[model samples]
Target: MRKEKVHINIVVIGHVDSGKSTTTGHLIYKLGGIDKRVIERFEKEAAEMNKRSFKYAWVLDKLKAERERGITIDIALWKFETTKYYCTVIDAPGHRDFIKNMITGTSQADCAVLIIDSTTGGFEAGISKDGQTREHALLAFTLGVKQMICCCNKRVIERFEKEAAEMNKRSFKYAWVLDKLKAERERGITIDIALWKFETTKYYCTVIDAPGHRDFIKNMITGTSQADCAVLIIDSTTGGFEAGISKDGQTREHALLAFTLGVKQMICCCNKMDATTPKYSKARYDEIVKEVSSYLKKVGYNPDKIPFVPISGFEGDNMIERSTNLDWYKGPTLLEALDLIQEPKRPTDKPLRLPLQDVYKIGGIGTVPVGRVETGVLKPGMVVTFGPTGLTTEVKSVEMHHEALQEALPGDNVGFNVKNVAVKDLKRGFVASNSKEDPAKEAASFTSQVIIMNHPGQIGNGYAPVLDCHTSHIAVKFAEILTKIDRRSGKELEKEPKFLKNGDAGFVKMIPTKPMVVETFSEYPPLGRFAVRDMRQTVAVGVIKSVEKKDPTGAKVTKAAAKKK
Candidate 1:
């Protein structure tokens, strides 16, 4: 008579010493949720501080000054329940001044786990040069955490004896164990961010244990921007997933920023595979599923629906059984591929929008704001408007995770309240909408299409940068580039291509140095997708398609009807 469960939040990130809180305290003590007399009092205080290999990272580092300065500093909530969902497990904080409590615990996660660190200078010093594992997988697809699970952690690969004596003094190949783990990433080591949960027999899960540490890529982009599907974790020994996927890899920049933050489902796993040798872990799992399906189809994804598996998360085998050492691999195990992922599909007829993000005021309850609707249906008295600051107001009440919600739909992360609007006339990327439906504009010039992915040189035209979109970031420019296409057959390969660089694929036009709003990606694909950034990476990724507006000048009634003709 009681079967309601189904809830999830998960966050955990990576880098700084990479074992992400001892593989999330050994996967929440192998799912029984600890308490064997609190792991023998944390193994008698880590064997009297000899640090008995950090007793499962002191089960979430419970600060005795974080287990005598072993690391993990803040955000570490927990809760477990599985058998089909009801998890929480945040666990962020991998050092660097507790990355703003790991971006406020990855902005209240929804999914993410990204650990990495398979020993040997730990996954090339957590993704090399000050690695926050490719900036927490590009800040979890720029704060939209569309699902990720990337584990790796090989339980400290038998404490890499001097990275296996500098990889047998450089002949163990795999590019000399990635040039001796990039020369030991400036003396690396230190880790945390741990969470745990498990379930199958259908849905309900949570797991975020991020942190890979290039000084905490802004808390791994505020915890992989709220994932939806990702489970990379390589390390199948032999050179641990070829030193985390070479070319200064954060596992290929966290699987190309989790497939450009939209995560179309993935699950590579391959972990320790019982430290290799089932014929070298099935030829390093068919050479990492043929180099991660040809680098996820050259960054657009589709590698035959993605799913590699072959687990071990420290001998748990295919991660919940099913590993007769590769009986020629048959798939589904990382908890049945996390219950076959899927999820996504909330558009809800589109239109309403939302954005905003934070406004508050609440003394008696007036100008709230918040965010997360991301498309149609809001309700509660309605009227809305918002946008680049067009204002309007009305809503009055909606709430959500805290209760009172007459409507609010599409992924609901509400807050509402509104009325005449104050708290200094609202802020945070505005947007809202619904005043009369399809009511949000501003652009004055759009067009997009993009692709790029990294710049360095050749972009042409004005090229301002910083875009972001959903929850708007702003500052665009570029002005025009019109056509360059061929991102795999869009054709047109040149109509204005004087420059474009890295993986091209243009169409351009942009503009937005100010008034933004947007919508076109065939009509609001979660605020018509975007990305761009510049000096901070994320080169490009676009959408929009068309827009213009701006007219309105009237000019004294067309100069008095042209002097009365």
Candidate 2:
């Protein structure tokens, strides 16, 4: 009998040059995951380019422009297996320009692995004031990565250490360090998520490596929102953990945001312990635990339940195997911790509601709509209704993952052909459901509870912002501010507040400028939650409380005139 495999999605995240790609590539290679021939080809190419040090990174940086530029410009996918699990690795770009790609990659992850550089100044630079490291971490936490693994890239640390030693022999200055780091910083970025799989001894894991630059925070939010857990990596060297958790750093922000987003579990990894002296490593470990635990407590996390492990990605210590260097530390290996993470319960028993992602017209398939089933079931031959267009069509066929199926359930990403629906009649962001049972309708106006995330100035009635709900993006106006409420307590504070500023929560009436399909949050959450964007950034997030249909307006006939006629 074939063994059943459990699946988990994981995303890799960190600042650029923190060895996110290298660590991921090396981990997969160390597991005997990469094909020998592919590695040989990459090695040969690196040798010919006189950049042989990039051979490992070449595994995921498959694009010619990326290899030439020595950076990951898009999401690269690869799959492998462990003794008991299958895994998918999503290698996302780390450059600031490709943050959109990172967001796309992170959005589908169930867990996250944050890679940190363990070099003397590397960690400091990454988590420094206004560094991408903190932003990426916070983004992962806010997006819902509850369980996390922090992997400090010791290989890069060793390389940097050697370079620094050589520079010191030549009486190097800070400018020299900047020059060296600058050379590694010039590379292109990407904006798409790649999908791949691997397996461990106990479960299947899908990993996404998201971008870490500040410009990509939007994408990062989108990516992390789908995760359930996260792993935080810290360098096991002097000043490593301190700098990361400092006020200007993102460690605290990431943890706090993750908690706010409902991620309840986290794994803190102290990486590069192998590179430090036993005494120093132990001391650093103790210091980090104390500092991080204190901060996590302030952020409302149960610090005692968070597992802290010491590992070296380069040396393969305490990752797939237990490390002997840290005799004092006793905890599960990185892989083991991943296997122990509990899968979140999926809501599949609700009514059928599939948010249309795209509409395509295949040569033979006619008109087909594609999307993930957010709730309930979809089957061929069912008469489905799509709203706000109110177009009714029959499902001619269903296809998922390139295979035909009689029916599709929640969480399944499927594309199905529809009968009597023209390509022009359909658009993205429409909801498809059973025509005879609770047919979808166009929402005329809705009341919502909103939390303002960002805004340049105060917002009053008639303030228009783009509402992003499911796959639908439409402009909506604040018809009225019914009440202002406390963000934490949800207590009513004021009625009809003149204006709302950043960080404020309120109950407001909203009217979409165009037709939209929305449901009350209490009834269908998948379609009820929305993001409000203005001036190109998300200003608020809201949930629909109730909707008022648009009643037709017409001229009334007078009773006296009717009698005379």
Candidate 3:
């Protein structure tokens, strides 16, 4: 027997009503990890609340408003054990407004599954229409997901499935994912869930299913951030169909983005294979394979690199076991792909860093800080300081679930008690570190790199947004826009521009509303971080470029100095 349990943190995401909860329910049921009585109790509660279709999600939703809304509003966590591994699922909401909640969930996972709807497929429309595909893919790469697989679902709906396959077929035109669409095309709605997984060789595994909807794109982001591998579902009957493709268009940008997100391995499940008559025909399967192969090549991948299977989740075809109808298609079952996936290793060598995501005072326990340990070892009695705020605290104890531990390594979701800190002062985004270093104090004059985004009018020299930094947020205005540069290449552009574009990166001198904690990027990356946001969306994300050696503006007058003046 293995003495140590292999722990895997997994997050399930996709568009709303794309079977995220249903799939999770099935996994829990098959694993025999969750209590049947608990499920039964939820079923009863759901019935009382008039949520007749409620199942496993009801047990986790926890919020009354969410129960009434019939969608996950926040992240709900549950654990299960397999013969080979112990897994935890961080289920997140599939709506746009709940993106913050999704980020919270994704930041904790070792791997993710990108769930695609084989029925509807990847689309040029929906909330996912805009720059979401590129944004999602970029975020995944930035977070360092090593491997991935795509899980495509909803093959039962042939019309929707045809549209999805067509979308994949047409996404091949652009040099990069972003160049494929203009502003108008980006707003179109996506309806299917594109599922995939990512992982490292021996470190960790994650899966994310990109949902096809504007409303559910947030779920996709959350899922991708937490994934190690992915799965792409396909509707066998509609393979190679053209519903979402425009007559004038020719390219496959959607599938390319999935691959770019570091998904090397793939499990293509041709769902609802037995639904049609003239079933198990050689010509049909061959034709489907050829069309899919052609599309894969156009997107710069070899057919041999991916394993394609046939299954039905509802009828119990090839989900966990081999299917009888699709004897011609010989491939691993869905469960086989999941079982064969390796776990990703936790990075232990890096310095321990934990971002203060949430902090609350428990009734019995004192000030408890809740956050995922990003790196390093966190032990009890460890002296740590919070953010640029320089608030210091001593760890009194550490607890995971109900069990208390002396220390917690990386990937452990443990809450620890801290002394001499007010609950209100220890705000979110503050980083906790083992070494003793004073947090950066906000300077009256500091330099920053800014990107100008949405506003009613043009943003000129003096642009302002609320700067949200570690444990502190204050109004900050750019006193001057120094020079503009490309966000990606980091190359400086032409002469000074009055207003910055949506994604332009530029250096600027900033003036804060009040003295807050901040540090020069050279000294401390954590304290140097800042995000600029308006009332609606994030306008810019920047780091402290430099701090003025002397205050440029002598607005503050010292009482003792007034006599000398």
Q: Which candidate comes out best when scored by TM-score?
A: 2
Q: What is the lDDT of residue 407 in candidate 2?
A: 78
**Tens-digit lDDT track of model 1 for 369-393:** 8655656789876776676555565
- Residue 243's lDDT within candidate 3 is 19
Displacement of the residue 141 alpha carbon in candidate 1, Å: 11
Clashes, model 3 = 92
Q: Model 1 reaches what TM-score against the true structure?
A: 0.34
Tens digits of per-residue lDDT for model 2 on 398-454? 985356978775534568998756788788668888766776778889999988755
Q: What's the best-to-worst order under lDDT? A: 2, 1, 3
lDDT of each: 0.51, 0.54, 0.43
Question: TM-score for every candidate vs. truth?
Answer: 0.34, 0.70, 0.62
Among these predicted structures, which one has the highest lDDT?
2
lDDT of 3 by residue, 107-176 (tens): 3454433333233222221112122212222222223333323233322333335445322211111100
Candidate 3: segments with Cα more than 4 A from true spot = 1-6, 47-50, 81-86, 121-128, 131-135, 155-347, 420-422, 435-482, 486-489, 502-565
What is the Å distance of residue 177 in model 3 from its true position? Answer: 36
